[model samples]
Target: MKLYHLPLSGHAHRAVLFLSLLGQKAELIEVDIPNGAHRTPEYLELNPFGQVPVLEDDGLVVNDSNAILVYLATKFGRKDWLPDDLKSVAKVQKWLSVAAGEIAYGPCAARLVTVFGADFRADEVIARAHRILKLIDQELEQHQFIIGDKPTIADVALYSYVVGAPEGNVDLMPYINVRHWLARIEALPGFVEFPKTAVGLRA
Candidate 1:
């Protein structure tokens, strides 16, 4: 398997973390997003959206962090990460949606603004990020993991940005449960630290 990624992208980090946790191996190809590598003709042919974290496996190309999570969990991970039960599956799907929807707009967008100096509607984005974090904190108060007792792709999908929220000037300290939850995710086997700065991309 080959993964095209940007080292500092939380979306890309999600895939890296999943592969690491599952003890799966893949060749990593760093994409220079700032240099428009993702937009090159060769790369655009792989993913029209020109996004990082494109996974190539056995001639199949998958993009989008959450989509990649689903594919990996279904194809490679244990049943606990992508359950076969109907209700359990729906629960997992719910969190994945939250990860893609609210998490994307809030923490991810804020990080882009801080790290890349991307123009964003600051107050709106920060407030939206906090709203999502508050809900997540409440959810964590009752559950050890997102869906069930064990960690799942849902946890992997949400972990990166939420853990990196402070870089965007969004404090997780206000959410006690979330702080503990982040610690729990960090304690998982094979977990790797995310680069603290955009310049730390090589790590």
Candidate 2:
């Protein structure tokens, strides 16, 4: 397996982190988005979306961060991370959707403004970050992980951006349960840290 990624990208980090947690021996290839490496013909052939974090397992290509997580969980037969049952699968899928949707436009977008200078409404994105975070905090109050007591891909899906939210000026201090939940993830075996950027409120 090979993972094409950018060091600063949270999307890429999620894939890499899951690979590590699964104890997979995969080659890591850094994609130089700064130099337009991701747009090259060779790269686009692997992922037409031209995004970092494209995983190639033999000849099979998996794009999108959440999709890669599901693929790995299913391929490895790790029912703990991604269950085979209908209800459990649906619950994990919902959180993955939250990670992609609310988490993207919220914390991820805000980080883009500070870290990459991408244009976005800072106030709006930060507020959005807090809104989703508040719900997540509430959820964590009842369970140790996102879906329940066991840590799943849903937890992995939401980890990076939420942990790095302060870099985007989205405060994590007020979300105590969310903080404790993050601590639990960090203590997991084979866990990896998301590279930090000193920008936004973190500056």
Q: What's model 2's lDDT at 181? A: 97
Residue-level lDDT tens digits of model 1 in 1-203: 99998888999999999999888999999999888898899999999999989999999999888888889888974787888899988988899999889999998888877888879986777898899999998888788887756899999999999888777777777999888888888999999877786321212
Q: lDDT for every model?
A: 0.87, 0.94
lDDT of 2 by residue, 1-203 (tens): 99999989999999999999999878999999999998999999999989989999989999899999999999999999998789988999999999999999999998998999989999999999999999999999999999999999999999999998999999999999999999999999999999998887888
Against the true structure, candidate 1 reaches a TM-score of 0.95
Give the poorly placed runs of model 1, Cα more than 4 Å off.
198-203
Model 2 TM-score? 0.98
| lDDT accuracy of residue 139 in candidate 2 | 96
Instruction: Give per-model TM-scores.
Output: 0.95, 0.98
**How many clashes does each candidate structure show, in the order listed?**
0, 0
RMSD of 2: 0.7
